[model samples]
Target: MRTGIRQTDVLIVGAGPTGLALGIDLARHGVDALVVERGGTLTPGSRGKGLQPRTMEVYEDLGVLDEILAAGGPYPVGMIWQDGRQAGEHRMFDPAEDGEEGSRFTGPWMVPQWRNQEILRARLEQLGGSLSFGREVTGIEQDADGVTAHFATGEPVRARYAVAADGGRSAVRRALNIGMTGETVDPDPLLVADVRIAGLERTWWHVFPPAGEGAGFLALCPLAGTEDFQLVAQFPDGTDLEPLLTLDGVRKVVADRTHLAAEAVTEVGWSSNFRPRAALADRFREGRVFLAGDAAHVHSPAGGQGLNTSVQDAYNLGWKLGAVLGGRAPESLLDTYEEERRPNAAAMLGLSTAIHRDEARRGAKTRQLGLNYRESSLSEETRPAPGEIRAGDRMPDLTVDGVRLFDRLRGPEWAVVELEDGVFLVRPDGYVGWAGDSTEGLEGYRARVGA
Candidate 1:
């Protein structure tokens, strides 16, 4: 047990998208943050592949939108096949107008989960944030002042606060004894893999429905900016999956379901199998430690809400943590992280489950641009009767006084948005914090937010 007095303002567990994004946000704010990952390297495989329009805005704010756009492509139309022949084309999402309401991104963009994390890691490092791979946290102890994380092999970490972004089976979450209440969204298991195959065009997302009873569906989507295709296959509820996780097993699934030969699959990059489940932590925060990403909520992968929601969780908590740590705001501001994010996580969980059960469609809702915090405690709408845009609504990217709204809202400081109807105080996270016809109560809100 090597021991010394090493400390940071915040200690982030798990170098996934959530932790890395939070680290970047903290670094830019000049907060001392350290990120630790249990693994020796960044996690691989295209686990979450879709980035919604709202997330694109977040990436833009984080200064990685250009690389994200250059590294990925638009979702391809689904090509449905039947009896080894071309059947028809299937559109996965409902058609939405591009750049609606001044948003720069229209629909979902395809960037493999691995590549997404790589970009975020680079940005965090570029911002001077520190991250340590292979630092597996075994236990965590938090007092009234700070959190101390004991790892499996190395010196412990002491910080003013800590976050668990380590995934559904989080070690810190378990050490804290937080309960996860959820239901299985689907009984059948799903096998997802990244592979290289011949004779498959990259123009379409190839879909192969089950051939007969006892068979399951399969889909092969060409991953953008890579030579790999994300292969997904559904298995019968009780089928054994151990034999189906190998390269040969993947080839068998592809050849058995589609019109291709088993030999067409040339390489297998990564593979995994799991049953879809939706669960949420009993609470998002326990004392000085907070749960973000999959540590707080688990979602079925149907509507691509898991990753986006998780990333937003970091975004919501990052600014509050910064404000409180910097002594700009009262510590009470930290409570709003759970108050605002938990409910949204619950809603997205239901939406993902609905889409998985085919009870909902991939439409405007799936894009996540309409998500808001109208009911949050931070939202103060002073008007007796408000119009469509109310306090807590996301401020659009329209130009105000010849300056883009996002450009003005950039950085960790709150902005006084001068709109046509009224003046709105935009939170660093981009939501309208307060709105009034004049600056009458603006000072009070600013004081509360440490602005």
Candidate 2:
């Protein structure tokens, strides 16, 4: 089944949302890329269904944030339940109180993972790039010249570099001998199902905590405003997944809180059993191969930060790779991938590893505002000063010239933000350099980034 080795500027593995995000960024930079997916089918139903403001900002910078928002449902309206009653809700992520100027993603947002993938896919297609489906990359060989990816079938692809945006259990990462060190769990398998119901308002996560010891818990998360929901429940030690198909079976679990009768159920879209894990690859890049998204880190789904972090990983790596390939930036710029993102990934890993039951976040800080990448190549020149958001501080939404990013930010380039005083400079990689009332300090800033 092997064909002659093929060549490309960049080769991406996995066709999930993370891979698509990377694809969109690479295409935006005018870097022709070939993205390959091992799976032949578009993952049915929305998985990992929440997008935070920072994520929205990334999408905005990508230029497709509006289309993405249009396809998404109402957001920041999630609630947690203890037993059968509501316990807490996500109501505020106020930017103004935090001293943020103007931003677009002012609150939390929701969008089915599939729709996000669809948007990125469409963008990739319009940008003259297509995904190679059903081609499983069995192996890879990289040298100074370029990288060659070997597939199980069809022709192999060769590129200047290969990016592994694969999922948590990335085969590419394993093959690279990358060490994923963290808490690996083998808890009793849990049931994860995506289904549609007729009588339910799909707005918040409905939790039915175990009333007694040894009893399993239940969590029903709404997706796309449809009665459809992704349900997760702990199993009694070792339980099989087939029984969930019966209407009575679903009622036995869902009826714990929702008054809806069993007759209201319609379809079961997808179901599986999994034990969540908190893992991080020892390194983000090696030789001509680099890892992005879940390929680099994975955490418990408790925080909904998994998808958000993966998208950010792609954002961090995309421009560095493009710059190196396009000959616009020096090779040393590539090292920042580990510097800026690894710390954040480590923090997320810590959050997931130390999760609190009945809550979606690890700590108050781990929420949307916890991400800060100060000590990066993008910030090495302009150190953090008082009265200004520092290099390692969260890149606050700057309101100047009417461009606002209150959500996930699309990036990989510098954002020339004009401040009232010194004209703050934003690195394309998403970091704030010098922020002053005047541009009187160009010599030091220019020397650091070699601009």
Candidate 3:
């Protein structure tokens, strides 16, 4: 019980993509935030390798898109193998036309999750934000003014608000006594690992279907910008999966399932096993503490929605937290964090589950471009009839007077754009907050949100 007082405007638990992204957002806004991670270092593994177009836009605003794009490449076509030979190509996502208008990004980019976390952590550090690793939060207590978080070691943290981005098994979330009700998307256990293997072409993702009855499927995806391939294997339901995390176990599984020899597996970087499931927290917020990312919603990785949704969760909450803490907006604005994000998270969870069961395809829905907060209390649609884009919808990227819409909405403040039809107020996260024929209610909206 070391007794020292460390104060920050916001305290974030977990240093994953969500916490790191939120730190970057808060740091740029001049908000004092401290990020604490239970682990000593960044979590390893290329578990979530798909970054949808919308997440790319968020990364661009956070000043890390260039690095992200440079570090990753477009997803390669899937190579279906038959009798240890290439059969045909399988497209994982819907194809996009060149030079699309609404988005600068065409489709999902492939970046290893560990590398993504490192990039975000670097950006947060560059912005003068602080992250404390090896500080597992044991308890959290919040009152009228602020919240205090207790850690396994070191002094407690006192902050105006606390965020749980600590993943599905969040200690903070459990401590808050919040319930998460969900269903198992698949009974089959999945083994995902990052490994270096020889004699495998990096040109395409290799798919190996189950050999016989009671067997499972295996897919080896070439992780961009690295020699590692993300290997995913599914076991029949009720099969014991505990032994698959070891290096020898993974090598054996690879040799047994694929055509490659066991010696081709040069190294195993990280490994884990899990049963796919979808769950959402009963509430995203409990008093001054809020849940973001996997702490709020758990999704199957089939559609690659988990990480993207988690990143967007931080994007949505970061500005609101900054605004409220800066005294620029009323505290009620914080309520919208849960209101707008929880429903969106729920939708993604269902999409992910559907994709897991092969009930849905990895198409436009997984890209997350169409997600909006139109029904949100924060959105004000004054138009009698909305056009292509409406209030609460994402502000599509377009050039106006030689300025990109995203460029105009890059900072921590809101911007009003005058299009052909009327005026639209774009939120800091690149969503249209209000739209009307004129700037009639714009002032009131601005004042209320402190935009």
Candidate 4:
């Protein structure tokens, strides 16, 4: 590794799913990207596991569907729960056919965040790319010509553009003096544990909400690599967890909530605390340094939209950045990244806050699949009324012909989809820029996209 200086067309900080997804997208266009990560290596934590249909489409296009499917778990049987008395149950989404256009992923995928990184790392190596770990970025200084980044250990790297995919504690954003607004919706602490729950052989995490002011809510979700369940419980608003966070205390909650026998108790592997955060940065880009994923936005793990949306954010921006780096489009095209992705991030933040307030969603959310962006520059040509705007709101998971689209088209690039009645242009980031009843010679469309 060169410590004095390094250079690449697009310098990406953080090799998490978002940064890695962006790297693959750039490589597909043959654009050179240098990825820097502050973490020593891939951290072994099964953080987020839900991959939405739109995100699957982006990943399939990037050529890593098989890996995801292999690593992820079985499709859940939706969710089953009621307010207090176990409200019956219902299927989350129709797995039979995905009706959405411009998207390839049908439902949600349950894979650990680390496993997602492992697959992306392998794919990066396959594409003749490399990553530098333990390269914590300390500051980012950008000029009219390019941007220079300084790390704690190395000299600096100059690039045409830089993206900050760093986690919630992003230094790039702070160094650039970016303002972020939003805070923890629940100031109280919740115990989050990832372990294989014994004696459970089926899908669907058994859940039990807290009883009253002194009780705690139980969140039992599935995980990858075993029959274990990810359990989360809310402690009293200001109660001290120092006494009741051990294996015995957590097991008592699980046993009481699910009514499982004592023999069903299993070993606790990993345990931690989580404070659901619902926040978004004031802006996604400042001069040459841009933000993505948690760096740009942070929200509760509700609706499983955080990771999926983050991946889509990178996918949407990657090609646009590559196009500019390769000189295919004017540098002004990069401005569209913030223009398009910021509003969508705000929407996710709002929805996630709602979910955190009340955790009841079982699986993939159909509403999340249908977010609309009529005000974006990417959709000026194919303007449609709110009634006419469907694909722009949500990418349907339906398959048109004999081929399955969702499994086939999730990669790190844009997918221009042609629906039965209209045509919708889907960016790799999983947002619909242009959608209308007809995509006839696309004269106006080409002029709008400037392609």
Give the candidate number with the greatest lDDT: 1
lDDT to native, each model: 0.92, 0.70, 0.92, 0.73
Report the lDDT tens digits of candidate 4 across residue range 366-439. 33556555566666444355344344454555566776555434554456677665777665455565666677
Candidate achieving higher TM-score, 3 or 4: 3
Q: Give the lDDT of residue 375 in candidate 1.
A: 95
Q: Which stretches of candidate 3 lie over 4 Å from their true place?
A: 1-3, 99-101
Which residue pairs of candidate 3 clash? none
Q: What's the residue-level lDDT of 132 in candidate 2?
A: 84
Candidate 3 clash figure, as a count = 0
Superposed Cα deviation of residue 369, candidate 2 (Å): 3.8
lDDT of 2 at 131: 88
lDDT of candidate 1 over 1-451, digit per residue (tens): 2249479999999999999999998887889999999999999999999999998999889989999999999999999999988899999988787568568778899999999999999999999999998899999988888889988888888899999999999999999999999999999999999999998999999999989998899999999999999999999899888898898999899888998999999999999999999999999999999999999999999989999999999999999999999999999999999999999999999999999999999998888888899999999999887867889899888877777778878888888877778889988889999999889999998887787
Clashes of each: 0, 32, 0, 28
Candidate 4: stretches off by over 4 Å: 1-3, 74-106, 240-266, 359-367, 382-450
lDDT of 2 by residue, 1-451 (tens): 2246665678889888788888888888889888888879655557677786678777877777878778776543547666445778754232223443334444556787777788888888987876888888788787778777777889878888888987888888888999988775436567777777776667666656676777777777777645578777776656775786455677666665455566666777777666778888899888888887788988777666788888888887887778777877677878888888888888877765656343333334444454666565566333234455654555666544565543324445564455443355666646665555556675566555543
Q: How does model 3 score by TM-score?
A: 0.98
Give lDDT tens digits, candidate 3, residues 1-451. 2247798899999999999999999998889999999989999999888999999989999999989999999999999998799999999887776546388888999999999999999999999999999999999988988899998999999998999999999999999999999999889999999999998899999999889998999999999999999999999998777787778888899999989998899898999999999999999999999999999999999999999999999999999988888889999999999899999999999989988888999988887888999999999999998788899999888889998767778888888899987799998898999999989989999888888
Candidate 1, superposed: residue stretches over 4 Å from native: 1-3
User: Each prediction's TM-score against the native?
Assistant: 0.98, 0.86, 0.98, 0.83
